[model samples]
Target: MTKPNILHESPSQTAGPYVHIGCAPNFVGIQMYGGKDLASNMLDPETSGERITLTGTITDGDGKLVLDGLVEIWQADANGVYPSAADTSGTADPHFTGFGRCPTNLDTGIYQFQTIKPGQTKMRDGRAQAPHITMWIVARGINIGLQTRVYFPDESANATDPLLQSVPEDRRHTLIAHKLDDQTYQFNIVLQGDEETVFLDI
Candidate 1:
């Protein structure tokens, strides 16, 4: 076999050790930068709507907990308004920060987020989407952060969500968070396997 004369593009890279020091310094107890680390907490008492807590662990294809994984979530306020300036649907809750980041516990590989349950938002096609939280994951061996959505299993709007409808019926349950209590939800993410969560491209 003949080798190529010119070099090609390099392959993608994994999260490695940098994702910890760079994205979540506080979690590891090496606070270099000022202020709170990314994904520390989503809101304070001033934020309106139903307060909720989400806890879970990141597992690999072999089902081992990934203690070093980092997660980021973006969602609309309780009133379904994004913090972005482009949102013209209405005014979003001034007290709510719709974005959050958190790293898994080093010992147990568990992660947590405190925020309000997001309200339903409209899709670009004008259909009202189900109340859902957008999530991103970065960890060792993952060249690119995987994307997914967390939908409330009890939400009435879930039936007609454009994205939910796109997923096959058999795999839809992976996207829905199970209710642990009135104010808590459990949603674990599986990187790969027969029961892997439904990851998205965008």
Candidate 2:
């Protein structure tokens, strides 16, 4: 009997130019979904927490701005509760979605998010994690979305965070955001090079 030829799996492809058209139509002026983009607003008036603004630029291996990148963030609420069915710690803020998404500005290549500073959340093993936001990024040339964490500077809890501790001491700095003011933070993401931000596999 002749041996059968095996088909190899198809290689992953980049996000492509149409990413914004489908993921954030309002951004590209497509005016879909009632003219509003999902995750554009993470909170309402009744949301509880210290409102904060996260702004940054995404740069490539050559230090060039990634003008078409899209960023998404997921985090727990102010009281360390997540708005998910799997979370049994406590009820999360009903007015806060705990998730957000934004595309880099075409003109300036900057992305920003207005949300609350999350509180420390417990890990599956019951250890407390530092207050941080889980960030995911995708762009024209990215075959797969990049995942990372945005840890706040000067948080004492960071010293004991299990995930943070797992990262190399020197590279751990890449995970921290710079505080610009009381409510503003800057967290630049470098796709590659000497200052490349550390990305998580998951």
Among the numbered candidates, top lDDT falls to: 2
Give the per-residue lDDT digits (tens) of candidate 1, residues 70-151: 8999999998999889899889898888999988888898989999999989988899999999999998889987999999
Clashes of each: 1, 0
How much is the lDDT of residue 180 in candidate 1?
96
CA lDDT, every model vs. true structure = 0.89, 0.94
lDDT tens digits by residue: candidate 2, 1-202: 3357966657667888678998999999898999899999998988999999999999999989999999999999999999999999999899999999999999899999999999999988999999999999999989988999999999999999999999998899999999999999999999999899999986
After TM-score superposition, what is the CA distance of residue 13 in candidate 2 from its true location, in Å?
Answer: 3.1
Decoy 1 TM-score against native: 0.91
